[model samples]
Target: MYSKTILAAAAIAGVQAQSSINSTSGYLNYTTVTGYFLQDLASTNVSTFDYTATNFGLINRTYPATAGLKANLTQWQQFEAQVNALNADAPLNTAYKVLFLGRHGEGYHNAAQTFYGTPDWNCYTSLLNGNATASWFDADLTPNGIEQALIAHDFWAHEIATQKIPYPQSYYTSPLTRCLKTANLTFSGLDLPQYYPFVPSVRELLREGISLHTCDHRRSRTYIHDLFPTWNIESSLTENDELWNGVTAETSDAQDARSKIVLDSIFSEDDHTWISITSHSGEIASILRVLGHQSFSLSTGAVIPVLVKVTFLPSGPPPSNPPYTTSTHCAAPPVTSIASLAQGCVCSGTAVGGITTPIFNISSDYPTSAGYQATDLGPVVTSAPAISSYSY
Candidate 1:
């Protein structure tokens, strides 16, 4: 992926030599081309905004590029035509693409987070594979999650039938189960163009932000292939997850750097202007930041479309991406949680031995183990005068 953005340099004395490229040789610049989507409008309150009601945030207006077209064309049709025009007239090293970013529906992890509350979820529950009730390691979508995806399916059908919205020319999804399931449900039966099929390429980089949470970990590539055999997996992907260390979480800056690299890979390799990416909240947020879009958080099952303008730069210094930082966790379920503090889980009892990562025993329901032995879950201490925080 770095091939597109960074120029290769010679290795000096068995160590990689850094290229001394000036302003003429490295990197790409991404700018969000506003005015095409209502999400970019200053007055559109994201919290109260519903895309299903507002025609996917498309501004129902004319475009000068499609001025000579038929007057009866729908807003979507006009928008598509204008996008085509923009691409057709684009100069060297410049291109426009519309990215449909869809977040995976409610996963068991999300429900667990809600059930346990954020503080406990962040501190204790997230570290374990599951409680007595539900499992969240590489969590699957809940029942409502399926319904949410179906709603997206129905909306897309409506848009295709009435609005003639441009269907995605290419499809991509995160390797995680929830995202894979969401992408499948949302696009499988759509009345799509002959050239554009529902076959999405599973990208390793598209998964949720790297973290110690078991849900953030992904199953093996073989397991993913067994489930979605028809979908193409990026050849570079390893069979097992090699990135997750179960000790640290990616900083926001680190996530943004990853997001930039992935976007760079897509833009350099793919020619499609309309692309669909089914991923997680954190990843989409990072991508939006890289694209220079405003911070508009998406609810699960919601989608955002952004018009992006990419410029290939000749040369620039590479960015310094910070390393992942260790996350604080509780050895046992905290007696009480503090929402205001980072070390919020107030644990009196010491966690003896907590399972850091999932046990890789294959099952139909879980690609990994059904649940791991959380030795850390000792008898809950009722009260404590002093508490100590632990890092997983």
Candidate 2:
């Protein structure tokens, strides 16, 4: 991945030498992640993201915010920093609560399509040969992804000192390598006097939309523990991935149910007023839906701050597949099947977007796969907007 971004000088003294070349970053630095889908010439038909609009800070809009509580690039970065600072200083009685939503940076899978082309390159042909899987399995951050995270770190560090926003007292991340890596990179270098060693919790529920794709099949738990020794993972997760099966994928309702579980666990805990959840684009959309907000799209490495009002009713049973509809994004076509796979199994209509769910049809509209759209729930849970900021 670094090879794609930073220009490397020839080896010096049997060691790698750093090149001084600029203009080497992979994927021209488009401010938003969704922008890639729009900007790719190959995907010209895909709708361009409304970068100029106020999109709840999910897309890469610039800060201070436009009207409508939209995020500029710095929304989460600034919020998280302020959260820690405020949490460390607030009086014992004051509990300032906020939820910070963030999406992971670009991974090998995102870059793969551009390099290999789609359909066969995206399906069994590329996956079975290990050509794509080798580079994208449980994809980690591309060089550009890391750079985005670095920008997040600097932005947060600068904002907490200067801006007035709630920073996160607790941090959570998806189990995927791309998301975990992004979380670590975004929060590692901050100079928070309150929480120096702010180790984030890894929740399996935070994983991306489940699918048969190799990129969706996470590494084993033991392997994950080894990879992220510092992260505090949920004890409940016992397998590499519990939901994804090559033959079938998780439905929007199922994913939303999972999102509810994530929230239930969080609200169950008494502490951590302002929390941060770092996950994939699909999972993030699920979260917004479960929280009763308009579905919003997010660019990788971007953040949104929502003033959420959650009502916890532990004794009551959870809603049964909340009444909802997903705007379909999958478009299917026949492709050569994997020796162990079926012809119509992958890339089927409305299922092509197995990992990310559906395309965010409108700039501010939620992506197709959101959870809990039912209106008859016992408690009233509402999600309103708040301000956002960042540094770099």
Candidate 3:
């Protein structure tokens, strides 16, 4: 519900003259401009591309606008010039932006999912706060997750130093704990422009799909602010999460509806041409769907840069949003489950549970920093070994 324009980046030399579009007053259309980034190419497979190693997927090519700049600029510098030129020449109703969508580093829940297998995790373990090993409720980034974020931090530092890549003028993150921590670690200590710091706004709509899993339930807003004091908590983010009810899982249609709403809010209010969003795999997928982009799943800690063209339109009928559906899960670990998470598992006992109520409380004693230990919670039932790589 909270969105705002970032005027700070307009001070950048080349972008100051761009025409502005009134995205708030009318309906809007979003389209992804292909042929610019390698990630968008039909031939480039996402399964193998490591964005950190590939200059964040910027194609190695020259832009028409770059001829006026220095002769030996890096590919990213040339690309930045091209984006600025696009914005500068855009019509009154159209605006161009480069959205850097990044998925958070591995969380304990991701590790838990891998350890327990998809079926068991989806049916039983995912509902519990944590087993003996660690807590996945509003799951924190594991040590490996921290390492992945640090890799992103180093990648950003190198990009800014060598490629002259345009840093994000405005930042946004999901209200979930893993995303909050990932955004902090990924952009915190970089040599950013004075006007644009790593102060990301915590957005409620950017959270993961409502699956009624403990990991999908977020902590209180106050806890988020206390952990990262400098972050901008969205104005409408309630002190406690108001949307999750632990009984119903959001349908893809429902998720897409909210994703469009959040994207529309951002496009209307935030005028910055370069933006960054840190969120989960499912939510990011929903955003890509809303933006009319191809289905490219991101590995944990991976980043994708999208060039988006948004046009304001006359108001029309709103899109239909299907209601959330009740998720039936096993009360205890199932004897066997289908590989697919969408299907129900087979339980040994006759008892089955439907997610209808919240199970965990957001305690004030939640750790204030990332340095807290699993031992602080209790003894380990089973150790969740650090996973180097995995995706949703």
Candidate 4:
């Protein structure tokens, strides 16, 4: 995360939730789900303005300027406005598009774990191990994950209704079931027919940060298509998870290279200027970098809207459509494995620390950049050593 604060334009509309300022954090964190999204969320609340039909504006959120992302977005918005001023007959107008990027809701792996108050050397391997007591390979969203999607869906629906946001003419998702499910859940009930198309296709290039993590391992294409019949899978994608091996994974540079190819295609094709991308938090960071911005962190199920502008010279070959390819390169460090410790807990994660009670911190014996939230995560591990009483 960067130090620059961004303009927050998307406030919760018709909210009846209660919020209190944390004397320590110095930000208003709303903890209720009374807002129409039908899920709990924490945001920096600025006002209590009630927007009615007369005073209309529904805001989901505005992206923070983390890691130069907001700066890139700002440049794109300016470029787009300039393009609109150019004559439609001019050749440059067709070369650019704006895409909205987002992450999936909580997956089973995201749910805290069940060490069950005692460590099992066989069952609980390294923090990066996916062979947990309760694991979901290439997982689907948990119930709480579904709710998070609904909240995003509600936000998009409201924004579309008020014309605060544009409708997506093209939609793409990672082949992973979790991402596919999240894309569907988020746009299922849009007021516009085209908002949620009959089929949202998967793009192999959109897969999560490839690594040794089992959760990153994808099932065969036939298996995924069998589960989601209405959706379309890329014919070029290999039948099996050829891109990922539990042994060797795609590095950040490789993923960034892939992000570039996919993004160029998305921007160059004359199909649609407004697009949506559903992918993982790790990979999204790479995508942001390929677009000429520094990467920022995203929690599970969080979204950041971006207005992308592709610059085309007076003469050049158009970008290739689909069948995009990227070279592999950078090894991502191991991410910690999270546990569900208790049943009925929501599954979510964030690399950034926040107002929520701290679970795993830098002080831990195995301090990790990774963190989990949703109903007690670490009391089981607290007594292991000089651990502090965990709260989040």
| Cα TM-score per model | 0.83, 0.59, 0.85, 0.56
Instruction: Tell me how candidate 2 scores on lDDT.
Output: 0.52
Which regions of candidate 2 fall more than 4 Å away from where they truly are?
1-96, 116-134, 314-392
Choose the strongest candidate by lDDT.
3
What ranking of all candidate models by lDDT puts the best one first? 3, 1, 2, 4
Candidate 4 lDDT over residue span 1-392, tens digit each: 11113211111111111111111111111111122111111342213322222111223333232233434333223333332332132232223334467789888766633232112211222123344355455766889889888877887776656443445667888988789889989987677564446367688778887653446667676766777877777776666655543333455665665676665444433245556889998888887776654345666777764434344333343332222122111122212222432111222243421112222221321122121111233342211110011111
How well does candidate 4 score on lDDT at residue 386? 8
lDDT of 2 by residue, 264-352 (tens): 55544424455788888898888877766555677777766564433322124434443222211122333332334332234554332
| Top model number, TM-score | 3
Clashing pairs in 4: 112-339, 112-340, 113-339, 113-340, 113-341, 127-337, 251-330, 357-392
**Model 1 bad stretches (over 4 Å):** 1-25, 335-345, 349-392
Q: Which is better, 1 or 3, measured by lDDT?
A: 3
1 or 3: which has the higher TM-score?
Answer: 3
List residue ranges in candidate 4 displaced over 4 A.
1-94, 112-133, 194-198, 313-392
Q: Give lDDT: candidate 2, residue 289.
A: 74
lDDT for each residue of candidate 1 in 281-327, tens digit (9 for 90 to 100): 99999999999998888899999899887777665556656676655
Q: lDDT of each model, Cα atoms only? A: 0.75, 0.52, 0.76, 0.48
Please report, as a residue range, the 10-residue window in candidate 4 with the lowest summed lDDT: 11-20
